[model samples]
Target: MFDTWSVRELANADHPPSVPLNPMGALPCIARLEDETGSSWWVAATANRWTTTHVLVLWRPDPRNHRQERLVWLRKADVRPWLHKEQATRT
Candidate 1:
């Protein structure tokens, strides 16, 4: 369900409005995000209530050190549909 306009404007969106947390049966979607330092990350959405400027993500475990990964909320503007880059690779 990838939209070329960046998953329904998540990448172009301004700050998201604050919402309440819905922890149960969260519908996650794959997204590519760039952090504050401009590091790209592949993450899954978990919740949206963490912060207005952020969206909660289900962080994956680190295989390098076998460390347990914790959930994180990323800047909304940094998130783009995972397959948004698809067209670029095809050419």
Candidate 2:
């Protein structure tokens, strides 16, 4: 879960695809991903999932420091719009 990665010795990842709001454009990415135990996932220091609502991707930059952060949270309705925007933006 987020806690695992958040507290791990090494937690970090590149900027996840920006949310659909920013005009910078969109990148292909997964959402609300879960692990085998049917619980939130914490792999490679990347945490995906927020609460029980399945709406967030919180990335950190090495557990050495929690100051570095990048967050992406989207609603159920944002899925389609985000996907459509990405498809159209793709070359």
Candidate 3:
């Protein structure tokens, strides 16, 4: 069966990113996702829309290994648009 997660049930032990990373390794974080059953916010998911319902995510400081981050595919509905405070100020 297709898995359905309410933004919380989604896995944090993410899969390695399906694409390349920015050489700078900066948090070009474009969106956020909730973690820990929606009790807390995991606010560092970067999004590149890959489809109508899925997003390619760059989850930093991976829960499984801090030294290396991972890339994960998440449902678009499970994530919310995020803007860094600096960006928010400009727009």
What's each prediction's TM-score? 0.38, 0.23, 0.43
Global lDDT for candidate 1? 0.47
Prediction 2 TM-score vs. true: 0.23
lDDT of 3 by residue, 1-91 (tens): 1112334344443333453443333334544444565443454566653555556666654444556555566666556667667777954
Candidate 1, residues 1-91, lDDT tens digits: the string is: 2222232223323344655457544544554654334445555544434454665655443334335444555566555444445544865
Candidate 2 backbone collisions, by pair: 11-62
Clash tally, candidates in order: 0, 1, 1
Ten-residue region with minimum lDDT total, candidate 1? 1-10
**Between candidates 2 and 3, the TM-score winner:** 3
Report the number of the highest-TM-score candidate.
3
- Best prediction by lDDT: 3
Candidate 1 regions off by >4 Å? 1-25, 33-37, 48-53, 62-67, 80-91
Residue 67, model 2: lDDT of 88
Q: Mind giving the per-residue lDDT tens digits that candidate 2 earns over 14-72?
A: 22354334233233343342334445443232324433332444444354577875564
